[model samples]
Each structure stands twice: as C-alpha cells, then as structure tokens.
Target: MSENETQAEVGTTRRGWTASKVLIAVVLTAVVTFGMTALLVNILERRTESAQPNHNVVELSDTTYDPAVWGQNYPQQYESYLRTEEMGLTVYGGSQPIELTPSETDPRSVGSSSRLEDDPRLRIMWAGYAFAKGYTHARGHEWMLEDQRYTVRVLDFNQPGTCLNCHASMPEVYDELGNGDREAGFDTVNAMTYSEATQHASGPVACIDCHDPDTMSLRITRPAFVTGIAALKASEGIEDYDVNRDATTDEMRSYVCAQCHVEYYFDGDAGNRLTFPWAEGNHIDDIWKYYEEDGHIDFEHEITGASILKAQHPEFEIWSQGVHADAGVSCADCHMSYDRSAAQKVTDHHINSPLFDANASCGTCHSDDAETLVNRVVTLQDRFVVSRNQAFDALVSLIYNIEEGMANGVDEDSLDLAREYQNKASFYLDFVYSENSYGFHAPDYTQSVLIDSMDASRMGELALEGASREDLEASEVTQKYAQDIEDRSDLEFLR
Candidate 1:
C-alpha cells in the first residue's frame, strides 16, 4: 500500500520490458546472420559448381546418334531436350496433340492437327503436290522424323530421299552412305528414294548434329546449310565464306536453326540434291529472283497450268528481317532461352515458342511482365493474321479467276501472265504462312510481305482481265532487275 511498493512494482515492469526487447533483438540478429550465411554459401556453391567441368560418364563421338548417349554427359540439357515431346498450345503456335486411331500403315496413335484440314484453301494452294494430299501442324523436334516417315505426303506420294535431309538426324546416314565423307553421303542420300534413304536415318535431330563431340561447341553439320550460307555470303561479296569456320558463337546459335528452317528446293539436275535458294539472298524477293534464274519448278498447278515454286518454312529468313535479329538476338536466345538447373546456367532445349515462358525468354531483354509480353506478341500476331487472311483471300480469288479464265478460253498470253502472277502470289503468301512465327517474328516485315502478296493477286486478277504485260509488271526497279536477270540467263545459256 505504500508509495515505495508501487515504485518497486513499476521498476519490475520496466526491467521485464527491457529484457523482452533485448531478447527480440538477439533473435532477429541471429535470424539475419543465419540467412546471410546461407545465401553466401549458396552463391559460393553455385560459382564452384559452374566453374567445375561437366563430368562425362561416357565418351561421345561423331557416330553417337542417340540423344540419350549425350544425356549422360549433360543431363540438364538432355532433360530439357526430352521435354520437346510435351505438347501444348499457345495463342498462335505450339503443338496440341490430336488422338488418332493407329492403322497398320501409320502406327502413330497421336499426331498434331492437320494444317490442310484447318484451312482447305491450302489444298487449292498446293494442288497437284503431295502437300495438298496431307499437311499437318508441326510438332516438337522429337516427332520430326516419325511425322515425316508416316505422313500422307510421304505415304501416298513419291518423295525423294532429299525430304529426309531436315526431318531426320543425317550424320549417321551420311557416314554410312559416303564412307565418312558427309558431303558425299548427303549427295548419295538425297538421290535415293525416300523409302530407301529413310531406312538409314537413326532418329530425329541429335546432339552431334548441332554440337561438336569433343568440345560441345555449336557446329554446322548439314552440307546444304554449309553450301547455302557460303552462297548467301558470296552474294554479299564475301567470297568463300565458310559458316563453320567464320561464324561467331552467337551467329552459330541461329545458323544451326537456319539449316532446316529456311526455304529449300531439290535440284533435279543434281540428282534431287537438297538445296537452299540463298544464292542471291534470303529475302522473299531475292529468293524469287533466284528461283526465276534457276528455272526450277516444283509442279504444274492442276487448276492453272502455272509452273509453281513451293516455299517451305522460312523462319530464319523471316526472323532475319525482324527487330529481334536486328538487336542480335539469336533463335536460341528466345526459343531455347537460358535457365538455371541447380547451380549452372544452361540453354533450355525444350524448343518451343517464347509465349510458353515469356519471362524466361522475352523477359530476358524486355522489362515487361510475362503476361504483358505475351499480350504484345499476341497483338502483333493478331494484326499479322488479319493481313494474312486478306492476302490469302485475294490469292484464292486469283486462283478461282485463273480457273474461270481457262474455262472461258482466255488467250494463252493473258493466261500465262495471270499464272505467273499466281506463282508469285502463292509462293510469297505460302512463305509467310509456312513460317511458324505467325508474324510475331517480324510484324512489319511480315505485313509488307502480305501486302506484296495481295498486290500480286491483284495484278493476277488484272492479267486475267487482259491487262497488258507492261502494265501488270512490277515496279520500275524490279522490272529492270528482272530484265537484267533474263539477260544474264541468256548469256549463260549461250555459254
């Protein structure tokens, strides 16, 4: 009851409060110290692990065609590589598996959606060609060989061994065919029947195709790409350019993909030799010029007896026209973006669209969030689709007009001019269509291509209406170039 007793109680409370504050501070300090220590240890471990060499359980060689064999040495990369089998859909691209009833002829019970069925216009576009028979959506790298082997394009039609050049891992086949001379093997394999050449392919693309066995550095293994790049460089005034020797590491990242992703043709004169038409350049116009000079026709259009040039996937060429390539971003930078596996950074081998992992892919350079980046990509693609549809519709209208013209007994010169226009329109439109990017790779460039395609279709329509060749011809510059090419061709023929 005394004042002293009250003061004593107050002092006891103050002491207890001070002791509680000290206890809290000590616990906080210990927690902070522990976290910092753990973080430092983690950093050190990661650094040490990254610095250490990859421990190889088995020796790989040029003969090692199995990806599983490569997996033993670089498990992280191999693991990601195997994930290529995982199929899912993105907004614009990425494969979605479609279930199929396996038949004796085609043993696969699952496949991607048919592109031909998705757009019947493609059938008309590729009429009189195997592609019109059947063309399916592209699946992962793992399915490349299997899809090629059993597709109606190969099953119902006659195909050269050259078709297998990009579909399967060719190093082993090349070795077997050419007695260790890959170029010779490439020549031999390309000349064989698809059935015979396919017999030698071990599997889809493997490590040896893109990587050196000893150093694991990127290399160009495809002879076609080697010749293609050299020709492309030569056109740029760089004579005797060897991609394997001259390309930088960053350039190789894209060049390896360019091997199979660019437009190509079979040189019948050279025994169906698989060839990339980059002798002039990789641009659509340049490619058109090259084809014009070569006079290599794929097939005669069934609807309009036009000599047509088939444009295969031209991803590399399209991408080269994009801002990403301008910024020096490689294909591997996006589709095969780098990710950490435990302690080391490795390129993700599950090659697919950047949309699936925008943060890991696009986010590497762009500061935008994943969803925003994806939406930006989709917006570009949406615009591209609108333009593409317009161009495609125009092309289809021309095809129909040409058919009608033929039925109406149009003059041969008029019909021929319209057919030539159809060839350009179809090939240009198909170039953009076949490219997997859906115009996200180079939005403006892609739009320009579509516009040109639509213009070609318009010119074809005019030709059908009996427009003069002089009026229907391309721009002054293009006309001059065409004349020069014709002049050169005549000179060469004389020689």
Candidate 2:
C-alpha cells in the first residue's frame, strides 16, 4: 500500500548517506594535505635561514639553560666544560690565590719564579697598558670571569669597554647589546669615555665561550678575533679565514681557544680596532718580523708610551709548537678530560691540569707512570731556570739602562730592540711555565721550550746593545712608549 512512499524514503536516505561520505573524504584529504605542506615549509624555512649564514648558529638562553638541557644539546662539550670546576687532585692548575707561594718566594728552580717575582719588569715595559699594573699566569677556566673583574679594577680607572675583550662570555654581551663594545669600537679602552659594559657583563666564560648554541658546534664569537685575524690575513696577503681553520679534531682543540687567547695590537684606524698581528705568522720571531723587520711599527720611547707589541697567553700557540699539539692533542682533549664511575656519570667543572686525569690525558697516547712524564717537565723546567734567571737578569738590566740612557742623553732609540728581547724572553718563559709538568700532556715540548726561553733571553741582551740610543730618541712614531724610569716613579704600575 505504501510502496511509492517507501521507495522515495529509501532513495532519499541513500542520497543523504552518499553526501556524508563525500564530506568526510574531502575533510580528511584537506587535513592531510595541509599537514604535509606545513612540514615541508618548516624544513625549507630552516634550510633557507641557514643558507644565509654559512654557519647555522643556534642561540642559547643562558638564563634558562639547565644542566639536563645542556647535556642534551652538547653531551661532550657541556659535560667537559662542567668538569672545569672540580677541586680534585693536585693544585695542578687550581687557584691557591691565598696561599700561592708569593711571587718573590716562588722557587727560582723553575720559571714560575720568573713569571711571578720578576713581573715588575713587565710593569715598566707596558707602562701605557694594563699589564704594567699587574698580570698573573692564569689558574684555569674558573678564574676567567674572576680575573676579568680583578683586572678591570686593577687597570685603568678610565678603562674602556675593550677591557671585556677576552674575559667575559662576551658573545652574550655582543648579542644582548650590539658590537659597539671595546672589541668593536676601540683604538684604546682609555680613549674617549669608559663604556658602561660592566652592568651587562656575565661570568668569566661558559658554554658560549667556544660554541654556537644553536648547532652546539664550536665557533668564534669574539669580534676582536674575527677582525684581528682579518688584519693578520690581509697583511699576509690572505683572504679567507679558511686558511687558519682547523680541518681535524686535534688542531681545533687548541686553535679554538687560540682564536681568543692570542697576542694582538690596536690599530690607529677609525675603530682603533684590536688587531692580531698573525698575518706574518704566529711564532715569536715571525710576529716580531712583522712588527719590526717590515718597519711598519710605531716607536716613540716616551716614558708613558712605548711603541709596543703585547704578548698574549699563547698557550695554544706555544702548545702547537709542542709534542702534544704536534701529535694532535687538543686543549679540550687534556684540560677537559672525562670519566665514567659507578653510580652516576659526571663531567667535572673543576678543570685544572691534565695531571688531575693523567690516565685520561697522557695515557691516551704514551703509556707510562705520570710521574715519569711530570719529571721530564720538571727536568726541562730545571734546565730552563738557569736561562730564565739569565733572561730576567738581562731584561732587568736593559730596562734599567733604558731609564739611564734617557738621563745620560743616550736617547730611546734602542728600546724597540729591547722589546724584541722582551718578547722572545716572554715566549720562552711562557712555554716553560705553562707546560703543567703535572699534566703530562706535553713533556718533550716543554723541555725544548725552556731551552728556547733561555736562548731568547740572551739574544734580547745582545739586541739591546746593538740599537742606538740616538735612533730611539729620533723615532718619535705615532705612539710613544715610556723610556724614563724616574719620570714614571709615580705611575703606580707594579713595584
């Protein structure tokens, strides 16, 4: 009886069901298509952004990064850096600031006595710079931040922002602010007005010290290094940083740190840029050749301003000339040695000398009692002491003569020659003292370096004798270095 109505209702129901199925398919297809597009866009965006900067750097929120987060980001380096704070083992490189054998009392059997006691000679040579005020051999990474603060306080009261160049986690400074800090906008930190960078400065150093947070890969974040290297490269007729770039793991270790801890000079250019004179080369004689041999340097032997070549902590550079660096042992490889224990795995922050982890360090290469390796360094250190004392004698005498010459009308002409001696003597002394006999990282290299230090000191005395006092007085170059001891009596530099 209701056949027609039943047929019509069935067809309508069937049509409704077909429409619902079509809608469902369209919605599912749209969702999936959108999802794929979003994913591709994300991947492409990352690629495009990274393409602009040859190095894809990631930023770390220093204020927010936790130990776990850091471990995830940089298991090797993060853990390694943390180990820098440990206080185990010998003082190795740890700070005994309060009890550090007073410089004068330090054993003269090794170069430590020269490094500590005779630091006053540097005060005279560097009258216009901070070193004249005071400088000490570094203890470890822990002291970096502390040293920065202490140095700033002890140096010029009118010091500019350039003071932050090597100490603080300056990458954070440059990022939080712009690159207008001392390393960027400087000819002199004491020039113009002092920067207000103190408020923005962070700790001595941290993960950002040698890494780009984004990629957790090593990168040079200091502008002084970038610009300094450029000046050096340009002077040497090189164009790319790739020339000095490390291609392997070993070289990168020390080279990464050398990117900052290097000798540098400020240019008289517009920015008075902090420049590294590495263009000619990175050796003692090589850098000297560029500074003096080429006749490109400024020299005015004024009591307050001496045409100068500052020697930075060439730990890496010196290490490079040593057996460990030659063998491809990096600074990280030794200084930041790792260990696995029973319950929890821990990377130490109490980093000091590799002596603390002798097995982890020297053991990786030569298998021997650490005492044997340390003894080699001590023996070399002992042999070098004779030369160190000699160099100290020569430097002290030359500095005194430089003062007397000014009084006797001898003139400041020979001061540059005097400085060359100073530079070499310093390098030799540095290598000897920095070898960390306890670390056993580079015993052979340490031995050879002490010998070199002794030789350089003798050579310095010879150079001082050869230069004319007349020439020193006449060469009143752009920058003048102090030559008179009596005139500088009140300078408040080291005693």
Candidate 3:
C-alpha cells in the first residue's frame, strides 16, 4: 500500500515540473518575438522619415517678416534661431548680459555691456559723432532692432532711415513705402528720419531678409548691397553684375551676411540714399580711395578740428581678405554649421562665434578637438588685441598733440597739415578697431593697416613740429591720389 501511494505522488510531482517548463518556454518565446517586432517597427519608421520630404505647414511670402511664422514649417531651424536671444560671452567677442536700470528714456531692463565704458578711448575717437554718445557691445540678431531703437545714439541724435536698413526687417517697410517696389521703397526710407523710418519696420531681421520664401534659398534683399556689389563687380570689369542672379549658393551664404556686415555710408545728395562705397573694391585701401574721391567726411572732430571718417563694422570686407575666404568657407559654414535633427539635416540658426561650439563648427573641417580649435581662435585674437592697442595708443597721442598745437597757437598751415594726418590715422585705426573680429579675420592685413596708422600718426606729429607738406606726405599711392580728395564741407552729418 505504501509503494503504490509513493509512485502516485512521484508521477504528480513530475507532471507539475513538466507544466512549469512549458509555461516558462512560452513566456521566453513571447518576449523575444515582441523585441524583434519593436526593432522592425523602429527601422521602418526611420526609413520612412528618411524618404519623406519636409512638409510645408504654411505658405510663406515676401511679406513674412515674422520668424515665428517661418518656424511653423521649419521648427528645427526656428528653435535654433530663437537661441540668438541667449546672451553669453566668448574670449574677445559675443555679448555679456548686463542688468540695466530701466529709465523713462530707455525702458530696457537688460542690455549688452557698453564698449565705450570698457574703453574710454572710443569716446575720444568718436567725439563729435553720434557714436561718441553711445556705443555698446553688439548682441545677437534677436536684439538688433531693439538695441538700435534704445541706444542713446538714436535717442539724442538725428539719424536717417538708412540706419534701419541693417538693423530691422526692411521688406515690409520697403513694400509699404514704395507701393510694392522694394528698390523705390528703399530710396524713400533712406531719406526719412530714423524715428520715422523705424515706424515702418515690423520687427528685427527675419527669414524674409535672407531667404526666398517659395524656394527657401538664400538671396540678397538689401538694395544698398545690390548696388554696392554691382559697383564692385563693375570695377572688376564685370559689367552689370547682379548679386542675386550671379552669386552661387556658397557665395550667397556669405553674401547674405555681407549685406549688413560691411562698411556703408548715406548718399546725402540723393535724398540720404543708403549706399555701400564698393564702387572701387572691398579692400580697406580701395575703400579709402573711394571715400577720397567721393569726399565723404563722417564728422569734424570736436577736439582736433579735423574732418574725420567713422568706420562701421566691416566684417565682410575683412573676411574677404582672410584665408578662410580663400578656402571658400562661407559664413554659414562656421557660424551656422549644419546639424542633424532626427532624420533631417539643417543649418543651425543660432548665429554666434564658432568658438561657442567648436566641435560642431570647426571640427567639421579640422581634425582637432573642440578645445584646441577654440584655443587657436583665442590665440589669434590675443595677438590682434596686442597690435590693436599699440596702434590705438599712437593715434590717441596724435589727437592730443593736434589739440595742444591748436591751443598753443601753432601756425595755421602747419596745424592744418597735422589735422589732415590725424584724419588718415584716425580712419585707419577706426576701420580695424570697429571690426568685430578683433583682427582675427585677417591678421596680417590688419597688422599692415595698423602699421600704416602708426606711420600716419608719426607724420602728424612731425607736421606739428613745422614739418613741410612734402616732408609729411603719405605713401606714393596716397600722394598720387592727393588731388582726388573731395570737398565734403557742404555735406551734413546724417549720423
């Protein structure tokens, strides 16, 4: 009776074990099958994404002045574009956010640090000009319009609508002013007062300024740049050259930026028409020659009593002379490097110095690590600063000498000659100084300009010591073009 009971219990135990094995096998098989299905689904989804094109959610046109509108169709780019509002500093450039005590005159509670306060010499350099009244470190694209509106230069002084050309989105304003004719609108706006012209602008620079809405391709929209580039090409013996038509995609990448970044002046004779003095060429020497022939003087120095020329930011001109330009590297290549967003690759819209993200920006071309690339940039900048400071000091000394000479009753003719020298030295120094790159754009070229500036200052000092005009004459090239200097006495400062 015991054997039969034991055998029955053993058989029951074996059946229980076999049933547990079957249950475990079923669970394992189900888990593996589920994992494989999930992987297959992910692969299919990615493949579909790769094959599909970007779907436009909304129609865009010339009048689309709001970046947010463009963002609807290109969310990845728009998201990056919004980052321009994020303020931070690099080694030598980029804006540092500072707290501003909001006042009745300026409602801004935040702003970039003041370049004038950082270096008082700038005030002296720009004295008798609106820039002396206000000059601050530049913020990103998002702040372009607001910063221009609130700056003391615009607040206390009179400026033409030309100032708004680069600071704000001009397409809508141009359309409104010219009754749908952008060029005609550009002309009318340039003639209006800054306060008046600014009323027409809807916002700061937007996608419309740089892109063709239908095709999403880069195009030049600024009239000043259009004419300027044409003049430059004509000088190079290319007749009727048109930037929008002639420039390649790579060239357009840089040209779009050059529209606002180069040196410019207002043509007062033509209703204060905003103009780029690119008729001669884009180099500093070419620009000086063009100004000499045009006889354009920015202002008369309050302290030195010399006709002074103020240089706007000349990034494009400087960059054109740099090695990177020779290598065919466009501004977008570094500042707006391409990035992968899910299945799509798009240009980053957070426009800032490449140093901020060297890996994404410089690492594309250079094999070096991010830190090394950044360090290289800083090193170039450090050398530039050293040279710039020396040239600046010399120019300041010349200014003081001219002032002292005037006060001490130096001969009128001698003082006049000294003043002329001061003008040359001042302009040359200002050209390099106002450049945002701090000379990193063209190190050797910048240094050469500084050397000429120092030489000009020395000549001015010699002139103060009663040196004859012949003794203080400039280079052969300058001497040859001496008679071309135009009389701008009748011209009024448009500021």
Question: What's the lDDT for residue 53 in model 1?
Answer: 31
Q: TM-scores of all models?
A: 0.85, 0.62, 0.85
Candidate 1, number of clashes: 0
Please give the TM-score that candidate 1 achieves against the real structure: 0.85
Candidate 2, 1-495: lDDT as tens digits: 143532343233211124664675457546655666666566558757653221211224533222323444345545565444333334334343332322332311111112334345555545555555555555555345444544433334555456566666555456545454524333333133334654455455666556545654566656666665565556658666552353345555565676666666555554445566666765555666666754444333235233545555556545655666666677777766555442333334455666655676666566888887666555655655555556556645655655665466543545456555555555455434443442234445544555665555555454456644344334334323335544676778834
Candidate 3 per-residue lDDT, tens place, 402-423, comes to 8999889999998898888888
Query: Runs in model 1 with CA error above 4 Å?
Result: 1-53, 340-342, 474-495
RMSD in Å for model 2: 19.8
Decreasing lDDT order of the candidates: 1, 3, 2
Q: Which regions of candidate 2 are displaced past 4 Å?
A: 1-83, 86-93, 99-129, 152-155, 179-195, 227-239, 242-246, 293-306, 340-350, 405-495
Report residue 253 deviation for candidate 1 (angstroms).
Answer: 0.6
Q: Please write out the lDDT profile of model 1 over residues 1-495, one tens digit for every residue.
A: 343543343233211124665675457546655666666566557657666434344567787666666786688788898667667799879887787776888866668998887789898898988889888888888778878988988898889999998987888889989999999999999889999998887677878899999889999999999999999999999999988899999999899999999999998899999899998988899999999998988999988889988888899999999998999999999989886443556789999877888999987778999999999999998999899889989988999999999899999999899999999999999999999989988999999999889999998999988887887665846774566675674576644
Alpha-carbon deviation at 472 in model 3, angstroms? 2.8
Candidate with maximal lDDT? 1
Query: Which scores higher on TM-score, 1 or 2?
Result: 1
lDDT of 1: 0.84
Query: What is the lDDT for 343 in model 1?
Result: 50
